[model samples]
Target: MTRRIEQGVERGSRITIFVDGAPVAAFAGETLATALIASGRIAFRRDGRAALRGLFCNMGTCSECFVQTAVPGRAPRRLRACLTPVADGMAIETGAGPDG
Candidate 1:
């Protein structure tokens, strides 16, 4: 049961980002990895071996958290979830990578 802690920390404006076509609530400044983890979506994508992978070395050094993201009129790209910030109406595709 993973959840975001909203105890005493100040957060940015609440927003929504789509993950695999499903709406995920997030804050304006939160990293995609943070929001996805809080949503209990551990597997960001599948590796070439077909194994599920999530955030590892979350500071963006490791490539374990790649996911596809799309912006209007732009080609979807594989991005490191840990380094990408969440934006309102942003769309993410999980487990839809080349080997996924």
Candidate 2:
């Protein structure tokens, strides 16, 4: 499991969420789902059935963590938020990608 230091985040500090086009700001140290939820992003991705889904199992197992992450120099990729660490300047989208 990944360790989180909530108090480590500075007061009023924010991180950017790149959802397709707009850049949204959320508090640092929050999970992709938590951060998005705080930003009013209720949907994290689409299931194989095209059903909207969000964080379910907080642990690293389960399909609930699926998210498409855009990394520098790499193509957009589907990843598990429960297993990924949020970094500054990350571009994330919810929904099935090539890997999903």
Q: Which candidate is the best by lDDT?
A: 1
Model 2 Cα lDDT, one tens digit per residue, 17-87: 67644586656666676666555665778878897787788787776868887667788888777667566
Off by over 4 Å in 2: 1-12, 71-73, 96-100
Model 1 TM-score is 0.87
**Per-residue C-alpha lDDT of model 1 across residues 1-100, encoded as one tens digit per residue:** 6487768889999999998888989999999999989987888988888788989999989899999976668888999999999989999888644433
Query: What's each prediction's clash count?
Result: 0, 1
Best by TM-score: 1
Please, what is the whole-model Cα lDDT of each candidate in the order they appear?
0.87, 0.67
**Residue 99 error for model 1, in Å?**
15
Clashes of 1: 0
The superposed Cα distance between candidate 1 and the true structure at residue 22, in angstroms, equals 0.3
- Model 2 lowest lDDT segment of ten: 1-10
